[model samples]
Target: MTIAIVGGTGPEGSGLALRWARAGEIIIIGSRDAQRAADTAVKLAEKIGGKSSRVSGAENKAACAGAEVVVLTVPFEAQAETLKHIKPALRPGQILVDTTVPLAASVGGKPTRTLGVWQGSAAQQAAELVPEGVAVVAAFHNLAADLLQLDGPVDCDVIVCSDDKEAGKRVRDLARKIPGVRALDGGKLENARIVEQITAVLIGLNIRHKGHSGLRITGLPAEAYEK
Candidate 1:
């Protein structure tokens, strides 16, 4: 499947594009600056170090045009504006995976603290802003971008939540494409409020422990992720 990472010049977005591209998925790195996005794609392709040509880049709206899935990895402050800019290109039946978190760092505060979003969470705000019929799935909140950039597997569990069951499942499947990562069914979209806040906690932990921390839910049977 072709996936577009909006704001793909950023660390989290570029890291995801790199991993997915390594997994043999078609990845489009989207940015406000088309040249910057293309540059990042070239860097990622070089990192893979092969004839791997599955990754490309474009302006945000253009990137979303033909993608089966659009992953938004912009900061919380830029989320609304970014979505509004790309709304025109989002077609019906497309899945939008929102990885934004309402971290207070966006507003000159500590990354360990979170801002209270009136829309309940960043993902909920995205669901409201996107054009209707585009399935919004909230995910990738707790994973550390530093770890994702490394060559080794990232030991992380992705909690995926959405109002649409199939869309959530599709995103969970996509999340698992990253090595050493597991995807969990995190229930309804409203639950994103809790999941997004976990990022702040994880950030705090990272600061206190001096390590890149991630989440893992134990005791879940393997069938929990089975179709």
Candidate 2:
């Protein structure tokens, strides 16, 4: 699938781009500045071997133009503006994955405390801003950025939530492509608020333990994933 990571210049965005690119998926790194996006993609491509042909960079709109999936990994503060900026380029058949957390991590406020989002959650806000045809899903909220940049596998469970069941499943399948990662259906989009809040708890755990933290749900039948 052709995946576009908007604000792909940041660590979270770049890390995901790197992993997906290494997995042999076509990746487009998007940035406000086309040059910066291109530069980052070039550097990242060199890291995984000089095969830069599969991965490229472009302005946000250009990146989303032909992508089958668009992931928004910008900070919470920029989420609204970024979605608004990309709204025109979003089409009805595409899926937009939102990994935004409404945390005060950027400000002086505690990371465990989430800021109030009038639209319920960042994913909900994104759903509201996008055009009718675009399906919005929330995921990857608790994945550690540092872990993503590593060459080894990541041990975690990705809980995917969306009002659109098919869109949510698509994202879950995409998440499963990552090594040692399991994807679980997290119900409706409204449940994203709960899923997002777990980020703060994980963040707090990471800080106290001085290590990257992740989630793993147990007791499910092993055959459940067969489908």
Candidate 3:
């Protein structure tokens, strides 16, 4: 499937791209600047190997145009503008994956006031911005940039929550491409608030650990009770 990474130059974009590329999926990296977008494409082409065609780069709209699925990897600040640019290009059945974490860091690298998401959350905001046809899925919010930069087995799982079951499943399938990871369906779109709060806790963990820490959830998959 053709998946377009709308904010592909960012850390989240690169991480998702690397994982999906390793899974042999065609990835198109999109950026505000044509040059930067093309650069990411070139890098992926070299790593994944092809006629330099397996991966490609394009300016925002072009990258999103005709894509079966689209992911938003831009910063919280950029998400609005990027979506405005990409809204016109979205398809009927396309899914928009949001990996944005809204936190305003102070000069000292600590956040003073946590940024509550505009219009509920990055995912919900994206859904409202896009045409009603597009389905927005919140995922990969807590994944470390370092983990995505690696070439093999990602150790973290992404929590996916969406109002649309098929859209959620589409992203769930996308998450499966990365090794040592699983995508847990986080019920419905409203559950994104809980999922997003986890990022803040994880950030605190990273600070305490002094590294790009990862997170996983247990206590799932209950066994069926016998009659």
Candidate 4:
């Protein structure tokens, strides 16, 4: 699939681009500054080495225009504005994967705390802003950017929530492309309120443990993901 990473200049965006690129998927890094996005894409391509022609870069709107899936990796403060800037390019039948977390850190507060989004969660807010018929799936809230950049497995579970069942499954399939990652069905988009908040708690745990910690759900059979 052609995946566009909006805000691709950021750590999270770049990290995901790197992983997906290595996985042999076509990756487009999108940024407000097209030149910066291009530069980051070049760096990622170089890192991947040998015929990494599948990765490229473009402006946010242009990136969203050509992509089958657009992944938003921006901070909460920039989510609405970024979506607004690229809204025109988002057409019907496109799946938008939102990785935003409304952390207090965006408002000069603690990173271990979350801000209350009037729309209930950042993903829901994204759903409200996008044009009609564009499906929004919330995921990657618990994955660490630093871990994604590393060479080996990330060892985490990505909780994917979307009202659109097919879109949710598509994202879950994409999430499994990363090593050591399991994707779970997190129900409706409204459930994102709970999933997004878990990031704050994970941040707190990371601070205390001095290591990046991730989530894992037990007791479910392997068939759970198949359904």
C-alpha RMSD values across all candidates: 0.9, 1.3, 3.4, 0.9
lDDT of 3 by residue, 1-227 (tens): 88899888887897788778777788899998889999988887787675457688889899988788898988777878889988888878788888877666522234422467657766777778888778889998878778888767777877889999888887888887888667888878877877776777778877778777677777766221000
TM-score of 4: 0.98
Ranking by lDDT: 4, 1, 2, 3
**Candidate 1: tens digits of C-alpha lDDT, residues 1-227:** 99999999999999999899988899999999999999999999899977359989899999999999999999999999999999999999999999998999999999988999988989999999988899999999998899799988998999999999999999999988999899989999999999999999999998899998999889989977553
lDDT against true structure, model 4: 0.93
Q: Estimate TM-scores for all models.
A: 0.98, 0.96, 0.91, 0.98
lDDT of 2 by residue, 82-172 (tens): 9989998999899999999999875668887888789899899999989998999999998988889888899888889999989999998
Better model by lDDT, 2 or 4?
4
Q: How far off is residue 203 in model 3, in Å? A: 2.0
> Which stretches in model 4 have alpha-carbon errors above 4 Å?
none
Off by over 4 Å in 3: 50-52, 106-113, 222-227
The lDDT for every candidate, in the order shown, is 0.93, 0.90, 0.79, 0.93
- Cα RMSD of predicted structure 3: 3.4
Clash-forming residue pairs, model 4? none
Q: Candidate 3, after superposition: displacement of residue 178 in Å?
A: 0.6
Better of 3 and 4 by lDDT: 4
Model 1 clash tally?
Answer: 0
